[model samples]
Target chain A: MELEALSVGQYSFIQNAYSFGFAVMAAATLFFWLMKSEIAPAYRLAITITGLVTAVAAYHYLQIMLSWGAAVDVTSGEVISTGKPFNQAYRYVDWLLTVPLLLIELILVMRLSRQETIKRTTVLGGAAALMIVLGYPGEVSSAGGLRFVFWVLSMIPFVYIVYQLVVGLKESISQQPESVKNLINISVYLVIGSWLFYPIVYLFPLVGLEGGAAITAVEVGYTVADIVAKAVFGVFIFMIAMRKSQEIEGTASTVSKPAAAAENETSKPS
Target chain B: MELEALSVGQYSFIQNAYSFGFAVMAAATLFFWLMKSEIAPAYRLAITITGLVTAVAAYHYLQIMLSWGAAVDVTSGEVISTGKPFNQAYRYVDWLLTVPLLLIELILVMRLSRQETIKRTTVLGGAAALMIVLGYPGEVSSAGGLRFVFWVLSMIPFVYIVYQLVVGLKESISQQPESVKNLINISVYLVIGSWLFYPIVYLFPLVGLEGGAAITAVEVGYTVADIVAKAVFGVFIFMIAMRKSQEIEGTASTVSKPAAAAENETSKPS
Candidate 1:
């Protein structure tokens, strides 16, 4: 919380990162929403959630940029504190709201059985919220010991989510038309890989980075991760929806994946 | 905006209304969500929106109760402000977020033409948000004349919504089975009838009631209306979903409703 004078490079890095993050999220929201009608009716909700996730992220990124502008002052050549704390909680708030939605988007796009869709969404969405809630206290606390404890606690849910994405939804992902099955798999990994950035940035202060360096690393790291996790992953989800819609409409006979397998897979416990 | 001391009766009345409101919204959220799988897949999103509307309402009602608790104290026998402004904005915030969803729920359940669904939801949902936004400035201001100006401004969108709800979807309602046609029709009336409570409450002070009396009237009136508009309307939406699901799954043949007539209804513009 101390007033650390930030070098111009350090200050500009975060500002630009936030600006880019906001732009991508807003763009993605518009893209997913506009394309919703093109998706199959069954999968339209998936696109809607994707739009909502990006829209929520876009709002928070704007808030982050405004908070950064208010917290930093560059009127005297060097960027330094205006004695206001940069509002870091916006990221957590954004995650708390959108993280579950992100998971729901995945489940909805799968077009699983009705009961399975409800079950998966409830469990995965609940776990996402739990993970974010557990991580917040550590995010705000300066004490490394307290932060580490909460980080470990948060990783419990994180691990569960990773397991679900990697193994639990494996069959559901496999049952998709052969064209998109692999893409959905890659999107799942992208979620896991990008989500890991949060905890890594969280540890920068614990691992010898502090002051302006810590702030820049944390902010820029999270922003970059968010762009990939939300924007990039969202594109894949959109593609999956688009391709699946096409496969569903363009005659189910064209898909190399056998129809009987998909029908049988629907009956399996998710 | 000087603090007014409320009698114990007045304080208890608002407190109890909020308690009941929160309970109803929370309960409706659980009911609609848990019963989701029972609804037909096409109608499930409408039920989901119903759950979200109530969940959002539940949260704001909790906030309103906490704000009421903090703003009023009866420790010295008469209730008076603790100097913190009771967050009256929570009401507008709740309405702003949930009102659009309420209209969207109606559209989704109608399962209108895809293009029509998109068009009606975009237009109607956008209008609901505009109505809420226009009403806020008036609610916060003590200038009766200024409030009157906003009241009229807000009425434009409100009238548009009432038109859409009462007459705009008339064909869709008539196209349903005899069992639910009347229920859905009554639900629309319930929506129109309940929504009028807010403006009536908004005009309470302007119409000569003031101070504790006005506060009591507004708080209690909005609470009652919210319970009906959200919780009650939500139940009706759920029933519509349930009946439609039954009609879809039970035997599309058992109904005397002509398939050709209903099929033709889908081509009509919303």
Candidate 2:
């Protein structure tokens, strides 16, 4: 599909998605920084990484938004050659930095042993980064065959990342306190589920979607996925951190003074 | 200022703002409904009402977004008549339903007596609805004089609402637990601060900003304010509700068994 012009609706959808992404990412960064919690050092590292992922994505999204805004020919509803070309590449740039961090953050919060954490982070993070880098070629390709090839190649790493999350992380997740175990599983599922949309968006043109409608769908779909994967996922991370912190504290108190801890537990409203 | 053509950028900005608003509001509605907390019945009512406000706003925003999307002449970057006229009135409709509910929700969360809740809800809600209704004519008017007239008329109720929030609610807010009293005060301040942006957006043309830039400014500004006023404000409300719930539960347990409660309190990590 040769790229030509976008409808006003298509342009707007794309622009708005970037703007929304920028705002939410920035807000989440600040929130993770400022939120008061007594989580363990490992969990705190996870929070920090989460903030970093958003902060990095936010900066790139701002660039994408401005580029899109500048490219639009207001009088023609056409995307023209702005002096600074519309940088769709920014999305890939963002994913390159943030995707790895996202995986690392999840691993950190699980409080796995140093060796296990290092191994999982390296493998999963590498797979995530490779998936994004591979997808970029498809995202930019005009030929359907070329796009499909790159997309399929990207899915190889995507499948690996999912396997790591669902199968490899199972034992570690099971070790978590009962209160947060389900939440961890849900977070993993959310990442996998929302991510499935990206590939569909990539192949929309191949599937007979073209022009303004296709562009609009792709932009809107990506925006929804980004929000779920980043902001909503961040919220789950924060909750898990808090829950883990409480559990650790509870255990420490019980160990230190059994009688006092029992009385304390009894008094808490069920 | 006669309403004329909108630039591609302007259309996109407006559409994107509405889309962003719709997503956030819908997400917030679900969050308030689904979040597990041990808050009081009164606080739960506040949560439900909070969800209601956002749900209503989200529906209206979708209408506004689609209307804008449909209005655009994709090739010309002009907003043409699409048998379905662009319904700018949807905003007023939203505010009419939500503004009053916003006030009522805040008051409800305070856990005031039934008599006080009804009194405040009626007065504040009425004033809020009137304020939004009065502002509609100004929003639609092309004439500066007519716009200013309705704007000033609307301020009458706006000022009254502000006075009620700050003065009438002062004593009640003060009665909250120490941890949440400041949060309540800050939330009120946040509401006032974010709301001030709306009138500024409404009067941008009066300040000499016109055409696409002005329209973009107004739309973007309004979206930012809405997020802060509704979403961020909702967060503060949640925190306050949780704090109050904790206080009440603590009091009940302490009253039942003083020694155990004290032990529980001391063991809890600050």
My TM-score estimates for the predictions, one after another, are 0.58, 0.57
Q: What C-alpha root-mean-square deviation, in Å, does candidate 2 show against the real structure?
A: 12.8
Misplaced by over 4 Å in model 1 are A1-3, A252-270, B1-270
Across A113-206, the per-residue lDDT of candidate 1 in tens digits comes to: 6557768988999999999989987877778999999999999999999999899998877766678888888899999999988878777778
Clashing pairs in 2: A12-B12
Q: Which tens-of-lDDT digit does each residue in B180-221 have in candidate 2?
A: 778889889998899898777778877778876776777778
Candidate lDDT values, in order:
0.78, 0.73
* Candidate 1 collision pairs: none
Mark the 10 consecutive residues where model 1 chain B has the least summed lDDT: B259-268
Expressed as tens digits, the lDDT of each residue in B159-269 for candidate 1 is 999999878888877887776787788789999999988777777768877777677777778888998999889988986886677567435542332322222232122
Judged by DockQ, which candidate is best?
2
**TM-score, cand. 1:** 0.58
Best by TM-score: 1
i-RMS, each model, one decimal: 15.1, 12.7
